[model samples]
Target: MEGICFLPTFLVIWSSSTFIVSYLIALFEHDVDVIFPYISEIGAKPPESCIFGLMTIITAFAGMATIYARYKFVEKLNEKAGVPPALNQAAFWIGMLSCLGICFVATFQETTIIQMHDAGAILFFVSGVLYTTLQSIISYKAYPYGCSLALCHTRTGMATIAFLAVSPTIICVLLHRTEDKDYVFHLVSAVSEWIVAFSFIFFFTYIHDFKRFTLKLRTEFVS
Candidate 1:
């Protein structure tokens, strides 16, 4: 009980501090490269640096809040019977091992075995996604666990596809005209698109579930 009481306080402070720092980094780091001629550029430099700085800080805080909330939710689930520590530990170890294996395989491959390295990377990601999905099914199906499972699946797919899609485009762009920054920006855009897509999917799913739940409650009351 006492432990639960401090969770919220820790979350508030952790998220707030991270948000401020992230916002400042984003604001001060902006350059002409960030601007898109067709669309408006956000956080463009202005005379009132403090205003943007504050906004940046708040945005950073909000990002940190998401992570903080996730941690708190997982902790609460552990307190409940949602997932045992052993299962959680196993899933973590498996994921870590998969990452290490992929890194090792990639390191050994020279230019002649680039294809092999790529294959290993793909296999690694696929196994990770399947492993996470299975683990989620084995664990109790509740708020944080279920949500984390969905997020993992979504993020895994995004990462795999984003790398595949962006890598070729970046390589091609670099081949034609060399600009490291341009390639990086394009890669970032591809990843941002995935995040936006997932956000919309999550938003609609939540709304649909809420409506269905409301309907069920109304039916029960009427009966």
Candidate 2:
């Protein structure tokens, strides 16, 4: 049961390490620019791309597990507090969609399937920010019941940063593409993308409530 508490931590480590290792491999191989390359660019080619795709596929499954655990944790908290389940349910589905987006991004290489890769990136960032914001709201609403005010504030702050980063990410990427591949816009876009991605990752760190819960499997027979 207590071991479940580490799931979120594992997810964070695995996801962050995947990107970092891929980035280093791409850097050493001279596949991407030295300064603020888009995360996808680092994994756009072979070798690193293979590693990135495989690791990210695993990360996506871990993300789904983590998000589903959080959803159930919140569901229990809401049940205890007599809070409506609407927000929690919404957050769960959106979080799942973000994980699906990750699969798309991982499978469709940016250079090979640029359109699908870009679409996946858009879905991931947009839905991820929304999911975190909704979870933050749920945290505040469930305050004093398996959640602390400080945790609520922290989630809200992270969500705000992620949400703020999203607009600049999209706008700067578009600007970089349209403005003759302007380096400034590209840098800003890359920075914002990293911020948004990590913000979403770190938000799951507030899984202290998971310590008290355990997942169990039972066999059933149907007639």
Query: Number of the top candidate by TM-score?
Result: 2
- Expressed as tens digits, the lDDT of each residue in 97-171 for candidate 1 is 444434433343323354554454444444444434434443334545344456545544444453444344334
lDDT of 1: 0.38
* 163: Cα error in model 2, Å: 0.6
Residues 117-223 of candidate 2 have per-residue lDDT tens digits of 99999998899999989888787778789677888888889999999999999999999999999989999999999998788665465567788787777999999
The TM-score measured for candidate 1 stands at: 0.32
Instruction: List where candidate 2 sits over 4 angstroms from the true fold.
Output: 1-3
Q: For all the candidates, what are their Cα RMSDs to the real structure?
A: 14.5, 1.3
Which segments of model 1 are wrong by more than 4 Å?
1-44, 47-51, 79-145, 148-223
Q: List the residue pairs that clash in candidate 2.
A: none
> What does the lDDT read for residue 64 in candidate 2?
93
